[model samples]
Each structure stands twice: as C-alpha cells, then as structure tokens.
Target: MTSETTRKKTTEKIVVVGINHAGTSAIRTLLAQDPELEINAYDRNSNISFLGCGIALAVGGTVKNPEDLFYCDQVQLDALGAKVFMEHDVLAIDTQKKTIRVRDLKTGREFQDSYDKLVYAAGSWPLDIPGVPPEKARLKNIMLCKLYQHAQELIKKADEPEISSVAVIGAGYIGIELAEAYRQKGKNVTLIDYETRVIPRYFDTEFTRLLEDDMRRAGITLALGEKVIDFAPSPQKPDHVGQVITDKGHYPADLVITAVGFRPNTDLLSEAEKTGNGALIVDGAMKTSIPDVWAVGDSVAMYHAALDRHQQVALATNAVKSGIAAASSINGIPGVTVESMAGTNAICVFENNLASTGLSEAAARELGLPVASSYIEDADRPEFMNDYGITRIKLVYHEKTFRLLGAQIGSHGEINHTEVIYFLALAIQKKMALPEIAFTDVYFLPHFNKPFNFILTAILKAIGLDYEAAAGKSLERRPSLEGK
Candidate 1:
C-alpha cells in the first residue's frame, strides 16, 4: 500500500472527471459505502449523468419527457454529500502533483484542485467524419444524436410535421435504434452502412438476414454495402435539401443522423496510450499506466477472454462494472476476477426483443474455433395462459468437449430483458457446461416460464443431447475445458 492509501484523513477527496451512467453510479455508490470520502464530480454539460442511450426511445415516444432519462439530479447528489460541479470542464491532469486543472465553460475561469485519488470515467464522444466541412456540422438538417442537448434538438426538429425523410449513417446499435425510432415517428428512414449488412460486428450473416427483414417490415430503408463519401446540400432544394453521396449513389435527405460509432474521451490523459481504436489500456484493477489515476467506462480497453486480448466493449454494463471495480480497488477491496466480460445485451425493437451474449455464430468462427451452433425457436411460456412468444436461441460449443462457449437470443417475448437473460450472460461468462445448466433448478411460473427455459434447452441441443439426457455430463466428463 502507498502512503496515500494509508493516510487516515477526515475525508478522502475523490474527484471523478466525467458524468455518465458509469461514472455517476460509481461515485454515488462509493460515497454511500465510504461516508468519509468526499466526492467531487465534473461535467461540462448542464445535465450530468443523463441517459444518453434512451434519446432514441424518447424520440420514438417511449418516454414522455426528456427529464425521464436524467438519472442523477442535484437534490439527490447533494443529499448524498457530493459536490456536483456541472458546467465545469476538466482540461488537464497533473498526476505527479495529484492536481487537476479545470475551467468553467460558461465563465471561462480556470482553477486547480487537488485530489487524494482520481477517477477518469470521461465516457465517450460521437466520432465525426474527417475533413467533412465544419460548416456541415452547423447545417439545420445535419445531426449527430449524442448528448441530451443534442437529442433534445433532434426531437424538436423531428417533431416538426414538415420533416419527412431521414438518412441515418452507420449500422451499429445506436444507428439501428435511432433509425427505428425515426421510422416509428412516421418519417421515411433510410439506414446506410459501409458493411454488406447491418450489425455486422455482432450477428452472423443468417441472423443479420432476420434482423434486416425485421427492419424492412418496420418501414426502414437499408442501403447496405456502401460508403457515405460526402454530404452536400441538395441541388434541387437549395433551402432545405441535403444529399448523402455514397460510393454507389446519392440520395436526398431532409435530415441526417450520424451514428458512425464512438471514440473514448481520453484526450486529457496525455500519458495513456490507446489499447484499441476506442479505449484506454488498463490493468486488472482498472488502473491506468499513470499511478493514482484510474479509468473506466466506455473509454477503457477491456480484457476480452474469448478473443484473448484487451479490447473495447462499448456497453453500459461493462462501463458500470469497470467504474465499480476501480472504486473497490481504490478502497482496497477485493473484486470478482473476470476472465472475459463480453456478454449479452438486450435491444428493444418496438414490440420485439433482441438479446445476445458472448460470441455469436460469427464471432466464434472468426476466431477459428472449431465450433458448432444450434438455433432453436420455441415458446418461452405455456400456451394455456394464451402467452405465446418466440425465442430464437443460439448456442455455440466446441465440437469435441461440448464445453459452453457463446449464446444469442432473438425474440419478441415479454421477459426477454428479465432476470433470465442476465443469468444466461453470467452462465456464458463462467463457461458453465450444458448438463449443469440444463438440470439447474431455474425458477418456474405460468406467466414467467417453464422449468427448463429455452436457453438451457438450446445449450443441451448444442451438445447433441436432449435436456433429460444431458443431466450428468458434468460428472461424465473426465476433464474440464475452460480458459484454455
């Protein structure tokens, strides 16, 4: 332990450099646990710890008010004895002196503050196209839905009855969700992706076909296998028209939402190098290369066990975990060691739900693992209750030992985002065998589920055995295969 860690002060001054789900929740939880720690948070935006992810949902009319997405309020944080500094931009960090230089964005005044420990959950920023005219960013129709303020503007402009067509760039989760939202709002939504298919990073070709069909059914136009070369105002309509020029063709658009992807907010930490295209390299405890300075959230490069290297997993769950891990390490508490964190995430496609955990049919094969997978679409609940929903569950396992490797689920079931999905995520991460999971006493109820849910059933099927026949494979196997 260092002298700083051992010092018994009345209150340990801890400063968090950003405000988002990962940073805000971590700061609040840490202060709650350690009352002796004084928490100071810095966010340049007026709305700190806002639910930027739900902006699309708000535009889709799922959320009534923009305030519904803001998780942390000043009243709540002040009650927790936190000094929440809004509109404060952290400019630089002097790690050696344990001081941070910050400026008030509104007033342009600068100040330096010292901290016992520093946490950089600086979060992420939307990536913009290079050499794109800066004036294009100022265009009335050009949009990048990122912060709460940006979403508010998009909502205001989209609500206008005159705005009819939208062009969404990039086919990642955010882009897909936003496109769906705009289409739901009765706009002609065109989704453009450089890849041949949408969600190419997560889904296999077959599964992507299913999702593509779903999007088309939802009234979204797909311009796949093309690159958006440039954006210029429409030649026909000088005042309001915008053109999306791609390698293949040019399409007219009333507005454009760029969801190309995000890069980690790590420019302030000049000493730390990138671990990947979108993240910072960190140790097991979330400590950066700089001492007494730690990083988490979408900004840090995480250890991916399946791929066996440090990479970025830009998801809310991992960000929150990384933040909490950094806090615990600072407090000298033990954390659950993780071999890999690439797990399932749930996406709401209107009434339908798409969820996946670990490697998909594509990611597993791309790693060159000799694997076999099964996709089974079955009922999740009893038909007697008039409750029938389809769950397409896929499980991938090694052809030899039948050791569990990866899982994905696509369904319109009501409980798709319920506890069962989270359990499967944990199961995949732990590398639980098929038989063990199949025989496990999962909760049962008529409205909820049956004894052996579709996830376990699918796992058993992947191992080439029925649920009943796979009951004792854990004991039958002479050796275990994990992290090898």
Candidate 2:
C-alpha cells in the first residue's frame, strides 16, 4: 500500500472559464496530458475558437468559407471527455471554496459547480466610448468587429447598396483592414483615429507615413489626429447613424464600425489582483495570486521579456501561449513555460507588408528605456538579381547595453522579408546585442537574399559595422543617440 507521504496528487476536476483561443488551448493541453481528467468549460458565447484575425480576410472575400475560421468547437471538446457548456455564463467564482456559480442561458437555471483548479480565460471586449451615451449604442448601422456574428454583419452590411460610404473608427489593424476591405467592395472608406499615426504602438512615424500614403493613394479618407464625438442621424433614416462627428470635422458615413481597442474581461473575480486595465496579473506559471486559480489570454497580463513587466498584449499568439503555460503547469509538465512573449505581429494591406516585434522606439521611450534605433532601406537580394525587391528595416536596442529591444520591417515590393522579424524577436527575448545578431549564420541566395541580408546589414549599421566595412576600418561600439 502507498503511504500518505508517497501518494500521488491528482487533479480530477478542472474548470475553464471562457472557450476562446486561450481556454481552448488550455483544455486541449490538459486533456492530452490526462484524458481521464474531468474538465468543465463554460462560455457565454455560443461558439468556440472563432479566430478574430480572419475577420478582415472574410470581409475582403479572400476567405470563401466562414467555417474555415473556426478550428475547434463545443462538440469536439464534449467528445474529448470534457463537458462544454455553450451559452452558459459563469456569474461568480470563489477561489477559497473552489466553486463557481453558473447560469445556463437555455434553461435559465442557476447552479453551483465545483473544481479542484480553475483556469480563467475570459478574453477581452471591444472598448466602448464613455462620451457616447448608452442610447447611442442602439444606433443602426453602427457595429463592432470582434465576434463571428460581428464579422458576418460587417460582410453582409458592407455589400448593401445603401452603404456607399463607410467609416471605421480607430486606425489600428482591424480598422485599417476593414477600411481596405470596404474599398475593395467599391465603397468610399474613411478611417478615423485620435492618434497622429496609425498603429503607433507597433510602428514609428516613418513606417506609418508610408502606410498612410498608400491608404490615401487608395482613396481611403484618413482622419488622423481627430477626436470622435458622436454620430449624427441621416435625413433618409433617422434611426441610422449617418455620419461620424469629430472634434475637427464631420464626415458622411453610411455605416460606422468601431475598432477603437479592447479591454480585458477579468472583472468577474473581484478578489483577484489585476493591472490598471483590469487584466489579471499572472505569474510565470500562469497562476494568479489566488491558490489553484490561473489566468490566461487577453484577460490577463503576463510578463513581457522585452518590457520586463506584465502587460496586456491582446494578441492570439500570447493568448495561446498563456493557455499552454497554465495547462502544462497544472499537468506537472516542467520547463514548458513560454520563455518569450515578444508580442510579434504582422499585417499586409494595400500591397504594403509590415511586421513588428518587441517594442517600437516610441513605446520604449515612453517607458523610460534608453533606446536607440537604426533604420535602413536596401535591396532584399543581390542588386544584380533581376527580380530583386527593396526592403526597409529598423532595429531598436538599448544604447548602453546594446541589447536588442525591438525590430520593424516594411516593404512595398512583391517579395516581403517581414518574417525575418521572428529572429529579431528571439534576439529580444534572449537579450542579444547587435553584434551577436550581425554574426548569425543566415543562408542567402539571389532568389531570396543577398550574402549579407537586409537583417544583417541593419544590425551592422546599428553598431557602425556597416560603415566600418565600407571605410575599411573597425568601429568598437555604436554612437549614443542621447549624445546626439
């Protein structure tokens, strides 16, 4: 007989709140570790694993099938020996008691469910404006673009003949994509944002200027540096939102889609410690402050290797990573925690390709980081190659330590090198310096890249090595930006 000291601890029951990417990842990882583990998953939404990233593709008619957006469903989870409650809402959670109060939307029945461990993956919600009154939310043709239903509504409503002019609030990825999508559908599109530059968090002014020039050339109205006040009623349809009113000016808009931002849906557990944005703070193991409780996805703030602090990065990549971390820790899997959360991202619109990882120069300076940057535009391959294309790169790093902090890649050519950001992201995570990046052994061919690729050239330029090679002299270190 096994003594009490030698007895193995078992996690028989686990409760997962929300079944988006984060919750779905956690559920799959846990079941793979132990098939017999009884898990109960509750989500307020009727669907699961609705990839919001594909919404723009769907809207642009690039994705022919809507079914392709979903990778997992409640049926699959149910068949995997885990009970999935669709349209079921978890009203409250008690970590001390290890129980949750749940309400089934179908039956309107309330009940209590017990769990040995809890994984909170509540995800995030589209940010709403406080200036716009609650009644304004009832305005017709004013929609959001986060959920599957929202995507369907956007695709359907955008095709209407009456939707001749479309205005998208917020010039972030979603807003810009939707604007370009509408333009592709032959509608006059207008993109509005308070920020002076689009995607300011991930891009600097130079990159955004190129993107903005492309958008303007495509006939998309860019109302940057304007504050949205309210929506006005059209004379034809008083109930519909006709045009968006801004502090600077008002533009005619038959339809308005708000893609302002997202806020984490982590307020359900009042006792849990959270960030200023209400995202739950999680440790390296994805465990929250409360015992037996873990938080993942956009609903939680995980430590960023580059930022050296917990931040709410609402990207599917981080969400999936957090979910895997939570489940692996619960399954007693060691050394499985994600070592990098660089917040890497990419976007292609209007034939312009852009990708970023870690931090932008503006974001780093805002956080009081002693950051310096090196930007260069050069041929992706040997200039002698007939099909060579131009690629631009910017490398940001700490001026003192020369540690890689971030990288941005942009190109208007057919052959894009944006994927090179993955290597830079690893460098930031490992705290590699510019000299190390310059020495990386990357394969090069005329069809792909030059012997000294654009990434290598960018790094060399950062540490004054490129000039050293040109002048036939060696330079020891990079010149300080602050000293300039």
Candidate 3:
C-alpha cells in the first residue's frame, strides 16, 4: 500500500464541525491523506458545500439548475464512511467536555458527540440592518440574500410582474451582483449605501468608478452616501407596501434585500468570552484563546500579516485555507501559514473579469505609506489574431524599495485575466522584486496571448524597466486619484 494509505490506516479520531466550502475541502483533503480520521460535520443546510458566489447568477437564469451550484453532496461524504448530517443544528460547544451539543432539526433529538480534535468552520451570516428586528424579516416580500433557499425564493418572488421595484441596501459584492440580477429581470433596482462609493474598501476610486460606470450602463440606480434609517409599509399603495427611509430621501419599493456584509458565526462560543466582532479570536495557527478548541472560516478572526491586525476576511478561499490550517495543527502536523487572509478574488463585472490581491490602493494609502502605482492599459494579443481585448492593470509598490505590494487587474481574456491576480499573490507572498516578473515564462499563441502577455507588460511598467520591441503594444501611465 502507498504511504498515504498507510497513514490513513493508522490515523485516529478527528471531527470537523460545519459544512461549507471550508469544512468540505478540509475533510476531503484530510481523508485523502488519512481516511481513518473520524469525520463528522453538522450544518443546518441540506447540502455540505455550496457555491455562494453563483447564487446571484442562478437567480438571474444564467445558471440553468440550482443543483449545479451545490459543490459537495451527501453521497460524496457517505462514500468516505463519513456521517453527513443535514439540517443538524449545533446548539452549543462545550470545550471542557469535548462534546458538541447538536439537535436534529427533523427529529428534534439532541445528542452530544465527543471528539479528540474539533474543527469549527461555521462560516458567516449576512448582516441584518440595525433598527430592523427579526420581526421585520417576517414580511412576506422582504429577505436577506443568503442560503440557496433564499435565492430560489427571491428568484420566484422577483419574477412576479407586481414586484416592479427592489431596494438593495448595500453596495458590497453580493449587493452589487444581486442588484444587477434584479435589473436583468426587468425590475427597477435602487442600491443604497452609507459609503461614499461602492466597494470603497476593496478597490481604488478609479477602479470603483469603472465599476460604477458599468453598473450605471446596466441600468442600476445608486444612492451612495446614504443610509436607510427606517422602513414603513406604504399607506397609499398597499401593493407597493415597502418604503425605505434613507438619510437622503425615501425610496418606494415592492421588495428589499439587505446585503450589508456579514458578521462572523461565533454565537456558539459565548462561554469562551474571547469572542469579539462576532468572531472568536485566534492565533496564527487557528487556535482560539480557549485551549484545545480551534476555529476557522468566517467564525474566527486572525491577524493579517499585510494589514497587521485581527481582521475578518469572509471569503471562501480564506475559509478553506483556515480550515485546512486548523486541521493540520490538530493532527500534530505543520500546514501552510497564510500571512494575510485577505482573499485573492476574481470577479466578473459586466464583460470584464476583475481580480485583486492583498490591499486596495486606498487601503494601502490609509496606512500612511508612500506608495507608487502603475496603470498599464493594453490589449492581451496582437491585432491580427482577431482577439483584441483591452486590459487595465494597476500595480502598487513601495516608493523606496520598489517591492511589489498589491495588484488588481481588469480584463476580458479568460486565461491571462484569471491567473494574473493569483500570480501576483504568489509574488507578494515571496516578496519578489518587481524587476524580475517581466521575464517570467508564460504560454504563447495567436488566439491565446501576445509574446510578453499583459501581466509582464504591467510589471515592466511598474518596475520602471523596458521590454522587448517584438511584444504587443504598451501604454505605461502613472496612476493617480485626480482624474478618477
């Protein structure tokens, strides 16, 4: 037998609690290495892993079936001799007793399951607007964008002709996507945000301006620098029963979806008292302040090496990485250490795929660092190939050292566009110099890319270096917040 099979045969008890992308990936990876590790997961949802990013696309009718978005099924887990409990709500975590108090939602039976090592990957929940109690959620047409069931219900409700207007109360990622989805369905969509601009924390003002322009072109109404103070059902028009009272003005609507970000899922560790900002405080190894108990995903906050503080990065990548990190630590093994949990996320906005890693320009500037940025706008290939796609790449670097700090790319070329951010992330992790990136070898083809590629072109400009004349066109420009 292989060493991996031998390791699995020798391994002992291990229980992973929660069923999201994080928990699923962790269990799958650990099982691959050591299948003898006892695995048990508890989630109130019917499925183990769900692609939350595709929920809006599914609602927009782009995705034919909802099942296509569900990542891991119960049968997959069952094949591994793992007990998959659907609709199993974990009530409490008794670290002292090493047992998790859980209740089967179907049978209403409670039980305590013991574990030698526990992995808490209980993800996150969307933020409920302040002043709107749980009773407000009782409204027939009002809901928050979360869970697959919510997406299905919204899709069905949004399809009604009577539901003409929708007030989405946030300009974050989910809010932006949901707004576009509603607009695609021929509904008048109004997005409200307290921030001055959408995605203020994620992208620079110029990039955000580009995104806003795309949103406006897609027929989305934005009420930025405004907060919804109260909600009242319309008295004059009962069919149009929703009224959102914002600081700027009142918005009339038929339905509302509050996508104002999320709070970590840390309610189970109340007795631990080390919880802050809805997440348990954890160290670099994903161990909580309380001994033996570990937390991962959105439910736990850790120090970001880049930002250097306990921050919550509620992305799927961070969730899965932290879960794997926690599992390895529990198994007395060394795992990958992610200095920064800020996700390297790739998103499709309009026709362009925009990807980002580490900090945004604004975020980096906020730390009082002297930062220089280079903006290179060029095509991904030669003009003769009939595949001309414009790409905008922004590279952030330290003014003194010229060390690569962060990068963001927006483009249409699928391969080059997707890998640029990931490649930049690797460079940032290794502290690679900017001058060395221009020579990195990449595939070349007439239909695929130009000789130097867009990424290499961007880096050469950022590092104040020169490239060969035989490559594609290049327009190197210093990026500033003035025109944007």
- List runs of model 3 lying over 4 Å from the truth: 1-12, 132-138, 236-241, 270-276, 281-285, 302-305, 332-342, 382-387, 412-416, 439-453, 463-484
What does candidate 1's lDDT look like per residue over 1-484, in tens digits? 7665665554578899887877776687677677567888888878776777898889988888988888777668778878888899999988889999999998899999999888998888888866566665556678788888888988887788877889999998889888988898899989998889888676666456777877887788899998877787766666554878788988768889899988888888877867747478887788888888888888888776445578888888887787778878777778633346765576776445666666776777877988788766556776576745556677776777665666666655354633455666666666676666677776788787756667766775676666544564331232111111
Error of 3 at 142 (Å): 1.7
Give a tens-digit lDDT track for model 3, residues 80-182.
Answer: 7677788999998888888888999999999888876777888888877776645545565668887888878887876899888898999988888888888
RMSD (Cα, Å) for all candidates, in order, is 6.7, 4.8, 4.7
Candidate 2 lDDT, 20-116, residue by residue in tens: 9999999999998888788999999999999998988888899887779999998899888799999999999988889999999999999999999
Q: How many backbone clashes does candidate 3 have?
A: 0
| Candidate 2, run of 10 with poorest lDDT | 475-484
lDDT of 1 at 471: 60
Per-model CA lDDT versus the true structure: 0.76, 0.87, 0.75
Q: Tell me the RMSD of model 1 versus the true structure.
A: 6.7
TM-score of model 2 relative to the true fold?
0.94
For model 3 the local lDDT of residue 120 reads 80
Taking all chains together, each candidate's TM-score versus the true structure is 0.86, 0.94, 0.85
Return the top candidate by TM-score: 2
